[model samples]
Target: MPADPESGQGPAAADPAQQQQQQQQQQQQQQHADGRPAADKPIKRYRRTELEEEEAKKKLLLLEEEGDEQYEEYVPRKKRREADEAVLMRLQGLAGPAAPEGDDDTGSEIDDEDEEQQQQQPASKAARPASVPQQRGKESLLVQTARAKKEAPPESATDKVLAEEADMMRHITQKQALRAAKELATDTVYTRSMSTGWKPPAEARGWSARKAQALREQFHISVAGDNVPPPLPSFALMKLPPPIASLLQQKGIKRPTPIQIQGIPAALAGRDIIGISFTGSGKTLVYSLPLICIAVQDEMMMPLEGGEGPLGLIVCPSRELANQTVEVITQYTDALKAGGFPELRVMLCIGGIDMRAQMDMLKRGVHIVVATPGRLKDLLTKRRMNLDICRYLALDEADRMVDLGFEEEMREILSFFKSQRQTLMFSATMPAKIKTFAESALVDPIEVNVGRAGAANLDVIQEVEYVKEEDKLAYLLDCLQKTAPPVLVFAENKRDVDAIHEALLLQGVDVVAVHGDRDQLERLEAIRDFKGGKADVLVASDVASKGLDFPGVQHVINYDMPEEIENYVHRIGRTGRSGKTGIATTFINSRQCSESILLDLKHLLKEAKQRVPQFLTALHDPLEEMEALAALSGIKGCAYCGGLGHRIADCPKLRSESKAQERSKKDYFGSGGFGGEM
Candidate 1:
């Protein structure tokens, strides 16, 4: 026989006609019944090989096994049963009333039947379309339950109790809020009404404005604000208590200084005041007398209980000043007690002292507290003391405090006061910035200025000398001989203070030194010895320049001119105290002192009617004409730093502070700092 073509064997399989016929038959079988040609159907372009298909089937089986294992591990039969029961109970609760007992039994029987059917089926049955309707029915039930819960009434006793408790807590919170608001409003109203309630004395009421102006002019006093009280003539005219008046007489203070003359009456009238006067002009007594009187009155009304007081707070800038203020107040307190008034206690709070001792004093109930800002803030922050009953607040050397970086602390302390209180700020020099600060901190304050603010004391004789740097030590002896014992020497730095102290000691002169580096006890001892007349000379840095009252100092020598004119004013003020005249000798070095400061010094000397040195007069200043114009316009000196040679924009202190702030920011933010890539 010939080659069999149907078997696709031998040479017949290679024939094109035979293959075409077979293809035609296969196409006919694949054609649609509507007579559409097979060519219209999509052709499969790629097909998996046998090995690829086998690998896919194996992957499918392995995935099925893994899914079964995970489902069994994640949801055991017992856990699934428990979860189903919990969900059913929740749905029933949301659906409203509980299900009947027979219905619960029927539901459990149905669940058991379904579980039995699932166990009899293969694992692949989980993916069958038969379960989709069951899942949809469960979702519809959940929706119905949520709708029912929204319409249901809250009738359970537990929910009613919780609602009542919530309402009670809300009511209590609202009550507390209202009480706090009422107290705040009362404080505000009282503070605002004080100015209207204040009145002048009978003698002061009758005086004409022209007469008052004449008195102020006669004493070189400057007053600002409305309803100012007239200046009393003497301590006796002040209407002080008999004990205080007698005490003043005993201390030989029959007459009040210009500051005391005006400040006392205003304070007695319960007016807040910003008292500006030269150093050694009885600024301390201005506040002290009022504080003592107020404290005494409080004590008489009701004796302080343990941890109950300080009725009055005096904030000083330095430890030495705080100690001195305590002494001054103690003297008046002792007099009050001797006169049969209630006993009052004064305590000192400062750094470098035992905090335990201060705490002990507080426990005993101190009526008056004289403190530095740092220590006082520490006590207040730690809750060791409180200002709840403190009604009188006085800031001595406020400008100095602000300069020493205590402005923030002062504001924080003010926040501790629970109610309106009397606030008084006294300083030798009140810069424009400090004046602005006082305006915000004090309420309707009266500004009592003894003279042009930052002006030198006229009672002191200022003598300026030019000395070569090398010959200063030898010429220091000549300046010392110009005055007697109890002289103060001020230097700009600690090293200079030590050098001068040693030189004086080697010369067999009784001298003591004080600087910031010295221990507190040593510094206090030095000051004590100088005040006691055991030391003829005291060499110190600018630490001694502010608010330190060294009585009977015949002379003050500036071993080095300070960088700022404010320091100079305070240094010279150490002398010329208590209506007594003294001498202030300053040595100027052309190389060490800046021309700006020298120009300021020259202007100050001219303003005080003192003789200006020839060198200072001959020195040419570019800002001289501008300064004159400013003075004519009633604007004098740098308002920021009290320098006559520059304005606030050009203030050195402000520039330095700004630079320091920027440096700190850079340090905190890393080398690239803020606004740069890390």
Candidate 2:
């Protein structure tokens, strides 16, 4: 073995005798070949006192005497019985009392053992394992800390009531709920008890024991079904659960309306229905109840996988009506939810808003859909909604919906529903076309007519005045002065509505106008302002006639007669609702008093037991008068000025007016119909 240059004294130091001498010198110096002292090797410093070292030694010795290996034995040494008593006594001194005798002795012993071990260990032994007794002590301390806290007491009665009221307030918006609350609080006559001694007509009252005979002769409630349920005498007697009954009572609906009394039972029996009731006859609830009941019943079945399709579909003719129906359904849905029913989802689908938002809402499951025909069809076409699971369907204002060019849309929507559904058609007037549609649509429906089909409200004091077209605005202004507002005035067209609205506004009469031409937001605001009493009069076209239920309407003025005779019934229906009396004045002109209009008005008035005007009665037969007028005017004529002798091209009055306007323009411009002063 030769030493290399890199190893300075390696070969020489390998000698046994010489290596011994060098190691002894290295030990004396306590130095390595690198000149770093061996004594300076990393020595950790600890600040433990002498007493802690002695205690740790004693613990080790105790472990050895007990025949426990420190590495293998995980369990801690038990504390002496006297030491445990001393620890308990100390705890009692701090707590001011000893623990109850019923306390677990094992838990106390474990805790004492844990405390003694913790006190015995030195702080330097940071790598020591946690003992069973230490863990037990921690868990017990946690339990004691938890037991020290107390639960909050139940809310007081007053506080509970207030919280419930707050929840109710949050359930519906303040504006909407307050409006309905005001209407109910101020007007109790409409919903008063039926037991009040004020008897209805013998024909209207069907309380006799002759079951089948009474349904037909008395009350005029006709049903053509195998097993139709009889009309319930009151809301409380219906098959409604107790919660619904209480909710109805809370809303102050003690007695059922004639329509509700007749329609609810038939609908709940799962039979189709054709309910012809006036507006504000509580028709919304008549169909709403059965639909809700059906939905609740179906809820017991297995839920639909892709979320629930509409269980009930209510088709409204107009967006306003659709939204109103949604509001009514939402109120009841909230009541059902409060009564521990499943969260029933409801959605309103209409146009003139975000279609994407509506689609999103529909894509998420909805239990009920209150929709206008156009919007509903749009969603169906887009594949964003389905109605195959629908078991209940209601067509509100079916007549008007059919007439509003929505028949195709409505038919398409109806086709989407299953054949097993219960169909309900609610119309103010049942025209032949409506009857035909219902016959094909419903399955042996029960036809319930509250009054005559085309009859006006008997509570409405209707009057007719022969006012010319030019004088209609003034006559309406006078009527506004004579009657109590808020008044709803109907015109034939949007132009007429705008003209009347402008006139009223110029005269400083707070007024609003609503028509098909206005955007949906504008229409909604106009209605809100009118309903909130910010506007004294609402000037609108026939759009407001059909399904809108405007409470507190003191008068309805027909500024322009509706083209269809059935519309006259619906227009007058706006007032005199819910047994409250109102006035309806029709401003008729000679042109409006044509035989058909006059005859229909007379018939409607007479059917409603109102005094028909003699002038209207005296009008000649419309068909005969049309023939006579045609014979008198042999040539094509201008209907605007009633030019019987010539066409509008040859009419003297029209030509003269046009020539005068041209001459005035020429004179204002001096010569060339332009300002020629300079």
Candidate 3:
């Protein structure tokens, strides 16, 4: 009041020097009052400085307050009393739980972290005061359930007030959230029990090794009385005649694959065999070895077997596969020296090629005929060929052959095989229908489920990305360019396939579409190009998923998720095959999200660590527990192995022997063998 501070007259008048200082102070004050910071003071030029700082402080305070509130909210109340009661019971160690015996959490297999969350969740139901509950006639409710009769404290004079004032505030905790989620999961599963009748997989009966053994010795050999077949015979010892074995050796056939070893003997024995060999598991060798051996052996054994040529037959689902079969036969048999091994004759009859040429070949009395079901049916219908003389029949792609809608042709082909004929059906995937085909085609066949059939190979670096549908093509382009060399990109539709083909063509990215819409010749050519390494990337629909098997392919990209999970297995098998490692990348877009697929993917991950990508984290496990329970409800494992509870191979005895060898080696070395206390 004496003098305005900005004016500075009062403080400045005492001394000239003091007045000078005062004047400086007044000058700064005046500057600040003018809505500008003092010249000496730092200023915030950004407009949000004060407001943002204030808001930040406010938010911090509010968060602390909210946390307190959340703590208080955990107090058990009527609304959450039941949940609270359950938690209280669990906390008091009163769940009446047994020990972790055999992972028997069929009702509620909540994880450990989830159980803690449930134990911490607020009670939703609790006893109320007489004013609120007298109308319901309150029973004598125990005050503290955490204690026994001898230990429990009596109800306090004002226990309600103390309980209400229990140093807490209410807010949602992680435990509460987890418990709620667990509750939702349990509710979903409990409401819908997951029990269903077991129906063994189709073709399961025919593809078994035992059945094959039974078929072989029972029909082919004269073990009429008590002569039972021996345990799993070697592939080298399969049904092929001595001449055929000598021929295969000339072709450098060294070690036999499990399927080949197990399947060949059974097939040669004229057993109906459903062979569930994985891709590149030498399933072809199993069927082909038997076919050639039986054809030549039968031809040689029965001089009257000389109707025309080899009597064995092979039917593949696709021309590409049929072509491969024919090529393999040609290569395997090219070394034959004998009345030409009697197995020497090999022919190809598939769709799109000239019928007259096939007819001409058939007239030559070919012994081993590899044909697509459709084309073979055509030849049979037109009387261009007849299977009446065939002794061995093999359905190479029995499952896919059926899936491709060749039921009628398959039946017709089966009709030509007499009861004495040996039938073998092999598939990458064995759906139920394959079993039906086996029962019809096979006579007491054996079933086999190859290893990791539902799993993407561990050696394959499987990757997935979430992306928009519109940008998928661009992403694909980027991936192709980045991946380089060999990459297979799948497309959802034929239009998409064509578009990608054209786009890739523009970029000089070697790509070709292999789909049903394409002319049969084009499809075959596309697959051939991929196999021959003429095409770097194969862009196609489901056709490339199964039919085309290119062992040289280093990469497989799922530009679109396969319609079913089984297809995913087969598609990825195209890569990481023939004991060579490969990579597969599946792009997950919103469009392809479905409960069934999501659940399948989850189980796929849980069972097969070999297929788990190094980059996969908990975040990538996008399946919702509730959705999984809902999807898995009313489903049972296939009856053969109790619904695939364990891997089909990896015999315990063999594993023991391998372990014994490893242990012996360790003992000989006198060092810790495998980083363990051995």
Candidate 4:
């Protein structure tokens, strides 16, 4: 109780009477004009107007009457009701009309009660009145609340909007389903009615193996399939359409070739076929006639519209083959059009040509498309063409396509087709890979082989000569002179073709050359001149080797022996066409020519009954000879590359190719590369 120097008047301030008097004085000082305690009031950051002050006073009185717990819950409930009312008003506006009378009576009553409470409150008290009357015949508020608790609540505006959206989506889905059903019906009807009216004859249906073998021997034709069709004797017996028959007659085709004998009927009967005959043996007609017939049938059934067509698709390996195929198809199509049949449209899609033109042709609707694999794949990738309606797919010169590394591209192109199609694979040889691909891609294909696959044309007199590497250019002219004008000289590479072409040109010979390096126009002109007799000698690489028809070509001179025996077969096949005998002269040497090819050539010459050179005869190995004998007996050889000289394990070409691939892989993806160490 002692007053220290740090405290002033501490003892007097501690007295109870003094403290009470000071508190009273302080309370009096804090009082406002309305006699409310200032300590209970909230601090105002900004001055309020008269209306805000009155509203504040009303809220304070309501809170005091209801207690803190009821005030907190009731105020939030009131706000929620107001917000829902605003949303309902917006939803009604979007719905384009007012709601029905009794649909929302509960909401309307609650809104009315709120409005009356706000209006009837006196300036002194903000508490709601307890005696507010309910609408006539309506349930009391407490009873309505109890009923709502027992039943599902009315749908909110958001829920109604979601329901309407779902209903609209269901209607759209139903419409789409109906449209799809109609399209499916149309497809079914079209498929049921479509037919080519071709059936196997009685003689073709059943025949003993001995009789079949004898017939095959007579015609030198080998066939393999279930229910193989017999060979037709004459063109008239084929029972082709009148126009086609007449056209064949006009073209002086009185009899069906060995390939056409069985291929045509099987194709017309809607069976997939693997046609393997020597080159220039009227193989084009086998696929062309069927393609035109199918296209004409499709056109007659329903005319093609824009962005719809190409019932037939022929994929070739090279541009020349594709163009040649298109020409063959066009000829028959023209014949059909002249004979009062539906006019068929044939398109040639190849590389080195403007794509816009091809696109325009597609826009106009084509009935048949003959295209090389590369260009065809490019168009398909760009979505400029589709195979939706195509029913006939012909892989012409399929061996050549596979050799040119187009097997993967062909598979990709096949994937573009959405449905089953009659696939025809025509080649001079059926390698094992091609056979496997055919088995996987085609459906029970008929294999029609005219004589042995990869056999040289017997009609052509094959003459092999040994010439030094330096002496080949000089000896080429003498070989060209063995036959009359219109001879084809083949080289293995473009450089040799150019060398031979230039030598012939400088020697005052009428010769033109073509290779992969030439432009499209140059190649076209070269072929035109050669075929039209404007040029006496046409020098070319293997580009002209496959599937090109040269009328009256009496001689084929190989400036250089091709690496592959299959190419050799195709090269000499340019002559001896259409049953006309011709001569083939091949130059060989120790260097720049593999012994395996020479062995294959010797076997081919011996098979064709042509004289073989002593060098080729001596170049053969005993193992190769054994394999060749087995190939002759079992018809099995290097089925991978169609080589008769070796099996797959001893294939020099495969070995070299594998080594090259390994080297390339090492170069690109060895250590410190993308693939890391191999």
Indicate which candidate wins on lDDT: 1
- TM-score ranking of the models: 1, 4, 2, 3
Number of the top TM-score candidate = 1
Instruction: Please state the error at residue 638 of candidate 4 in Å.
Output: 2.7
lDDT of 1 by residue, 1-678 (tens): 688757877655777898899998787867766566767876533222333445656766787877744422233343355466456545555322232355222333333445654763464234333422222224587899998899998656434533553453344233211012334446544444133233456777899989988998888898888878888878766776688899988888878889998998888777889999999999998888877877776677788999988888999998888988888888888898899988888999999878998899899999999999999999999999998988888999988887788877877787788877788899988877667766666767899998878989999999999999999999899989987888999999999999999999999999999998999889999999999989999999988888999878989999889988899999999999998999999999999988878988988998899999899999886566454446443557565667776655456666776666665564456667683335
Candidate 2 deviant stretches above 4 angstroms: 1-209, 215-218, 300-307, 621-678
TM-score for each of the candidates: 0.70, 0.60, 0.55, 0.68
For model 2, where is the 10-residue window of minimal lDDT?
188-197
> In lDDT terms, how accurate is model 4?
0.74
Tens-digit per-residue lDDT, 95-148, candidate 4? 222333542223233334446446644621322223322223457999987888
lDDT of each residue in 545-566, candidate 3, tens digit only? 6645677778888887764666
Could you tally the backbone clashes for each prediction? 0, 0, 39, 0
- For model 1, give the 10-residue run with minimal summed lDDT: 172-181
lDDT of 2 by residue, 598-632 (tens): 66566566656777676776765433333433344
Better of 3 and 4 by TM-score: 4
